[model samples]
Target: MAVDQGTFRRAVARFATGVCVVTSLEGRADHAMTVNSFTSVSLEPLLVLFCVEKEARFYDAVIDSGVWGVSILNPDQRPAASWLSNRGRPLVGQLDRIPHHRGPETGVALLDGAVATMECRTTAVHEAGDHDIVIGEVVGAAVPASGPADEAGALLWHRGAYSRI
Candidate 1:
């Protein structure tokens, strides 16, 4: 039997996951999006991966940029996450409203108050149904000086809701 989309979505939502903003810059164009599908792929090669909807505005920017940044949101970054995720919002103006800084290594913008951020160079891309799986090799990472090492204040997503870990 073929599983329906709602059934798959609801089932996957049961797994609580951290929130992150994936960002990229291609020449004068830049884009950011809230994502929860980010993951570590391998440590031996310092690899990571995140999936983006093929139709998302930021999708092509990420592909063309070849490098991207992942900002692991903290509890206080709920607004940033919400704003970036809204498909109706203007992509050009999204970053201007947030407290952010450009990654020194990749030039992709990183959210300022995130618990941690990482710069990754895209190593591979695969089309996965409605989304694109981007595999990257981590090149640099940073944590706030006072950020918690534990997951106490990490921003989490579950059952179509946002929560604190």
Candidate 2:
């Protein structure tokens, strides 16, 4: 039997996932989107991947820029994640309200207070259904100097809502 898209999506939603904001620069403009499909593919060479829908405005910018930043969201960043995920949100000045700093290596905006951040250069792009899987090699990374006791837990997506872990 063939599973329908709704069924597949619902089944996959049962698995909890961490949230992240992927940022890239297209000329002097910045583009960003909330993504839960981010993951690490390999460690030795430090590779990571994230999937972006073909229709997302940030998609073309990211594919063309070849460099991007990943900000692993903490619980306090839920608002930023929600804003970035909205459809038809302005393509320009999207990051203006969000607190961020430029990544040293790629110059992409990395959200402030994120649990961790990574700057990557695109190594490959693969077509998958309506989305493209972008794999990148990490050239730079950052984590706060605070101890574990002061760190905020990660923000997660579960059952269509945000949760903390």
The sequence of per-residue lDDT tens digits that candidate 2 reaches over residues 1-165 is 999989998999999999999999989999999999999999989999999999888899999999999999999889999999999898878888999999999999999889999999999999999999999999999888896513888999998899998
Best by TM-score: 2
- How big is the positional error of residue 77 in model 1, measured in Å on the Cα after superposition? 0.3
Under the 3 Å rule for N, CA and C atoms, how many clashes does model 1 have?
0
Q: Estimated TM-score per prediction? A: 0.94, 0.96
Error of 1 at 89 (Å): 1.2
Model 1: residue 140 alpha-carbon error in angstroms = 0.7
Q: State the displacement of the C-alpha of residue 63, model 2, in Å, after optimal TM-score superposition.
A: 0.7
Task: Provide the lowest-lDDT 10-residue window in model 1.
Answer: 143-152
Each model's C-alpha lDDT?
Answer: 0.91, 0.94
- Candidate 1, superposed: residue stretches over 4 Å from native: 147-152
